[model samples]
Target: MPTEHDQPATHAEGTDAAPLAGKHPAPPCALVIFGAGGDLTKRLLMPALYNLSSDGLLDEGMQIVGVNHGARETSDFRDELTQSLRKFAADRASTFHTSQLNEKAWNWVVERTQYFAGEFESDDTFEGLKQLLSTIKTGNVVFYLAVTARFFKPIVEHLGRAGLLKEENGNFRRIVIEKPFGTDLASAKDLNAHILSYANEQQIYRIDHFLGKDTVQSILAVRFANALFEPMWRREYIDHVQITAAETIGVEGRGRFYEQTGAFRDMVPNHLFQLLGMIAMEPPNSFDAETVRDKKAEVFDAMKPLTAQDVVFGQYEKGPAGPGYREEPDVAPDSQTETYAAARVFIDNWRWAGVPFYLRTGKRLAARRTELSVQLKTVPFRLFRDTPVDRLTPNVLTLRIDPAHGTSFDFNVKVPGPVMEIGAVRSSFDYADFFAERANVGYETLLYDCMLGDETLFQRADSIETAWAAADPVLHPKDGPLPVHGYAAGSSGPAEADALLAADGRAWRPLVDTRKKED
Candidate 1:
């Protein structure tokens, strides 16, 4: 006899991570991965494929083709992928971590894996891919451009010229492009149009892995699914919303890339906006992919244009973490790029006309936390005005996204035998405490959804453009560069950001997560 932890993992053999019982495997398709030799392929794509295999979500007939510029034998490519997968499995620190690799599932991926070598701009690559895909059993195909931004257009065009994006015999053909869809409004529109020239909107999947967190996906369930929170979700009951995506690590060696794309454009427009859409969207009549996306798009469309007065920018100064943003390698000493940005946004709509939404993101901060907090307005009449309490404890409902996956509500409560004193207590719900864990790199569901032609989780062109439109004013402030304030790397952000909220007579919830721990 063995305890649950001692038993070997199995597919459909009654284990937590195996046999997605009611879920069916995706339709058979060939997953043609561009930039196969890159980090995204090994770090994310491979792990997602492995998880899909483990849970019996990947069709047995599915084939994987790895395309890159370098020459390598198919066996060598498979071996390298296997080694990478094993490294991720053995590392407890990794998202895809596990004590041992699933041999049967891994073997399935390796058996179906193939490799192709050709330059993205060269016609040879697309022609080679077209010929190789012809031999694959399934007519359905997914072209995933795991490469950099520069190659996005050229590769799509090459595929178009080679007739690789065509759907034949009633089989589906799709392409998944990773984001930074574009830096600003102009670039985003250009990119959208460029891609549409080669492939229709329905055939493209603009994926954002950052939105893959369980807490982010559960925003709808947290709101509409609960009667208590839905009615109080509008401008009337809520005071404001705070969206924070903070990281403790500075630009390691990507300072060169960071120099071009600042914190605001890098995050606020896409990741934060997508999360905002999820939090702010109206309840859809159905979860039909298009229906849900339309509601999300509406949120973006309603955003009031941002200006310098409503935004604050910051750059990290040297601290215990390491060198400051400018001192980092490849960064200019006089670089004006912002490492942190905070903005005051408004949705000029019926439900949330006057409500303010504060968003902030930074590379070096006191904590690495990504969460959304909804602080409700205080009661009109302070019932315990004569009590020991100076004022009511502000009611805040927090949906903690990464690092800590949970929902917590802070409200006033009576202290036991404390002479009519009121206290602030948090009633929290954690994913780990309530549900079984899964090996996820945030790419599993997006990959499966793409194979099934579900675009609800992915961004639409209109949403992307509208989100960029909201950030455009801030990105290109009419008056020279918005003054950049400096803060210690280990601090929350510049003091100016605090002023952004303080002016509204509100303050940010502390960066540190304060939750009572009970063993």
Candidate 2:
């Protein structure tokens, strides 16, 4: 049995080459993408496919069929995507090495891609799609619904009506749906039911781009691969865990969408909870999809129900230079939607009974970063209480997910002056400092995984519902308990969030203060 830990030694270009050591090469397939004319296609999906081609991971026989409502010649579609690829490269130049297009690789991808123009709900459109697939040599097919949430069911129904969902001649068929999987628990369940009606659980892939991130995946390796952290990963030894995902820029033109989906709905139930699951899940028998997902589901099931008092919501006010949430384009002046959210969550399981999981996320905040910090309980000071050294700070192990990728440990260290003084010092490991940074749009790993039938990084139906259940109280508070507070665009968040932790004699780690020092 091929384990998730298996990785192929090398990937060769030709069909005759054996599959790489641990990784099974993706079988020849056609990825039919709906809403190919949208920003997501040009910015993320296409770029990821191109990168896979450049890496020699994409199969030579694979094809990409882009579906949209407008008619365009194949050459015209290729030309437009080419320009988009150039712009994407230029935009990401400062971040990763793969920001620039590999001309040869781009050309290879262009040759294998085609465009189909048709209305998503039309029977003729899907019929035409079916006919196109018949002409290709693809042995597998992946229908990617990249359109708005509303179009998900209609497109999947059309695919089934056109008999595209059925397996043919030993070939497999899979459908990949993008996130905001559902608005809440009820809707998430409904959506899952509808999708499953058309496709089996094994054939569905729910994509959450955050899970594809390198640092996010590292959370698993840090806990399971090492014996140093797991034993101490409990309430007895850990004070609290803080997960913060802050964005410096405001909604940027997504005011309309943000109006319906606030911070709690937008980030907490999906991205943040996924992080929580990774950090809290018990070690699985293996890293395979079923085993790993089972462990993650257990984490969600063990979460204690939340109350209004356990959550705080905030809308960004005008900053020194930026507009407030209401002032943004397409936003209502009296909008009650929250752009910032902070919550204190608890797990009822034995390993984390009393440990509070502090979660926070906001747009137009003081910084653009995503990090997870594990604060260890302070050591007893009976021996050093009378010493000249001042108070000692508790140890902290932080995992930086973006804007920087790596981990750091903060601990007490003696001051070199030998005056019996104690200060906190951080030993950090940055990915870029040690390894070559490649061009990444964060979708490459996900796309590759999907092609290889790996659902370990994808969200399961149960996991989605479990997360929504935990977030229901905040989303639909009863008795007028939860209120949306206000914070300036450039500030951290509402002061009330700080008070949420303060009430427990703890404070949120300062976004600006990377380390603590004892005087």
lDDT of all the models against the reference? 0.86, 0.85
**Per-residue C-alpha lDDT of model 1 across residues 1-519, encoded as one tens digit per residue:** 000111122232221344476666677788999999999999889988888888888776788999999899999999999998888777854465567888877887888898898999999888878888888877888999999999999999999999988876777779999988998999999999998998899899999997676678898888888889888989999989999999999998999999999898888988998888888999999888889999999999999999999999999999867779999999999998999999999999999999999999998899999999999888877567475323778899999998889988888888899488787787888988988888888899899888877888888999999999988887777897799999998999999999999999988888875666665
Where does candidate 2 clash, by residue pair? 7-22, 7-23, 8-20, 8-21, 8-22, 8-23, 9-21, 98-439
| Candidate 2: segments with Cα more than 4 A from true spot | 1-24, 95-99, 385-390, 514-519
| Model 2 clashes, total count | 8
Q: Say which candidate scores most in lDDT.
A: 1
Q: What CA root-mean-square deviation does each model show from the true structure?
A: 5.2, 3.2
Once fitted onto the true fold, the runs of candidate 1 whose alpha carbons sit more than 4 angstroms away are 1-18, 387-390, 514-519
Task: Output the number of the TM-score-best candidate.
Answer: 1
> What are the models' TM-scores?
0.95, 0.94
